[model samples]
Target: MADEKGENPVTVMVVDDHPMWRDGVSRDLEAAGFTVSATAEGVESARRRAAAVQPAVVLMDMNLPDGNGADATTAVLEVSPKSKVLVLSASAERDDVLDAVKAGASGYLVKSASVAELLEAVRATFDGQAVFTPGLAGLVLGEYRRMSTAPADDRAPELPRLTDRETEVLRLVAKGLSAKQIATRLSLSHRTVENHVQATLRKLQLANRVELTRYAIEQGLE
Candidate 1:
């Protein structure tokens, strides 16, 4: 079932301190047909295992035994830049969520999420979509808006210019519309909408929809 890129069911790593939670998540991923590459109980172990496994997605818990998951996320990305980290934590604190995002997490999900939601989030993360629990999406966008108001840094590189349609698509993306939804709204094919999204990501040099959403907010599109 592997694709051309060798990611068939999508490889995943589960990182959580709690043994039961870790096992449960790993089982769930396996049951959902994902390849559970590894499981770790702490940030340091997670970082090391992530480097070795290079899983497509790392389901990380923010509060780990050795260190914060956010720092581990950064470390993991350093070794496996293509891997996407999705924070699965009980805490919905704004600071925690923002910290993980700044550290390069692809999404954030509270532990209260249903099994279906978790499964969908893992797939979405693999597909480059930004998955956030309920109201947290707006919070993330608001944070970006606040950050954008600050004075520009001279050292910062200029953003690449996007086409009108790309910009429109980005705006809708920042508003949390999926490609299919955007396609329906814009009277375009779903594939075309996905193409536009990919184009926007390339032009913006962004990793995924989360970063794209941040860029849109920074550009005052939100």
Candidate 2:
């Protein structure tokens, strides 16, 4: 996996308590031409190794020795803010999903997902898409909606000015359109669409597409 934000090949770190599962995931990622830079079995180890290696992605398991994945996720981002976490867990409980996302996870997948789905998810996560197991995505988005009950004019922070085209791009983003899909819909080049998205992100002081989408949804863009 090559990090689009940098020149070096992107590296991944696997954080899980089960050795066999961790090793198996590492091997699978490696077989898919991904670089597995480190592995950790607990919250402390995850935070420490993430600080050291600062991998591009962290394949996280919810159950760990020291603490749960949410704790580890917050700790890892504290050390390595650039890394994106994708939860690969056995649990599909609402609290687990929300906790992981709120703690800075970029995606969540149940352990039941096939290897092919996992591979595609990793690729999507690397590309900054907020991947989730089918129903989970809707649940997360609905939570965002529920959290933003107040009308934007009533409680929203003053938003920075966005160009009309940028606003259009953002609405599409809120609708879960990929950059490529947005480009096709808007009759623009993909690079141009990406540029618009990046510009929107910077102007809004957002970390990733997930935040961007939330912002858009809060503003009633979609």
Candidate 3:
């Protein structure tokens, strides 16, 4: 398997200042069938290791010894443009979350997330989807809305028409339902649900589910 950038899939770099916490999370990810390819503490180390390994996903912490996750995210991506960053932090402050997103993080998850939830978020993030904790998705969306700089017309993109099934799938996707859950809800197979999702993405000209979810929210489906 490969990521959107064609990097090896499930290969991750865990970035946190705390050794024990980082090691524990690395173990959990390894147990869940992911490859913990690299580990780093603080901003500089993260930047260096990410450049060297270019892992498919970067698991970042908000507060590092040298800088915050946002700083590290920007630096790492600058060096390894193909890396996908997912902030797994203890902080949920509005500014911190916004900063990380603005710095190009694919998603944000709080430390309180279960091991299962964290693993799933990592998978979604690597899939180029916007994975956030329960309430934080809404928070980030609303914040982006408030901080919009584009003209109103530019922000309101003209959407392409979608089939009824595709529309149903899009709504579930905007609500952050996984493909499996959508399949169960609509009495369709998972592959069928994914087909609908891919069809919708093609119709909308969206690159990934992250953009698809944002478009759905703009259309009041979220």
Q: Which candidate should be chosen as best, given lDDT against the real structure? A: 2
Candidate 2 ranges with C-alpha deviation above 4 Å: 1-9, 150-168, 174-176, 185-199, 207-210, 214-222
Q: What's the candidate order when arranged by decreasing TM-score?
A: 1, 2, 3
Tens-place lDDT per residue, model 1, 8-53, is: 7789999999999999989888987899999988877987898899
State the C-alpha lDDT per candidate. Answer: 0.85, 0.86, 0.85
When 2 and 3 are scored with lDDT, the better candidate is: 2
> Of models 2 and 3, which has the larger TM-score?
2
Q: Least accurate stretch of 10 residues (summed lDDT) in model 3?
A: 1-10
Q: Following a full C-alpha superposition, what root-mean-square deviation does model 3 have from the true structure?
A: 4.2
Off-target runs (Cα >4 Å) in candidate 3 are: 1-9, 127-129, 145-168, 183-196, 214-221
What stretches of model 1 exceed 4 Å from their correct place? 1-7, 151-165, 191-195, 207-210, 217-221
How many steric clashes does model 3 contain? 0
**Candidate 2 collision pairs:** none
Q: What is the TM-score of each candidate against the true structure?
A: 0.84, 0.79, 0.75
- Taking all chains together, the TM-score of candidate 1 against the true structure is 0.84
Tens digits of per-residue lDDT for model 2 on 1-222? 555655666689999999999999999999887899999999999999999999989999999988899999999999999888999999998788888977988889999999999988888787877777877766765666676786767676767999999999997886667989999999999999999999999999998897886566456564
Kindly list the per-residue Cα lDDT of model 3 for residues 1-222, writing each as its tens digit.
355555655799999999999999999988877889899998999889998988989999999989899999999999998888999999998788778877888788999999989988898888777788888767765666665666776675555888889988987886688899999999999999999988988888888887787666556454
- Of the pair 1 and 2, which is ahead by lDDT? 2
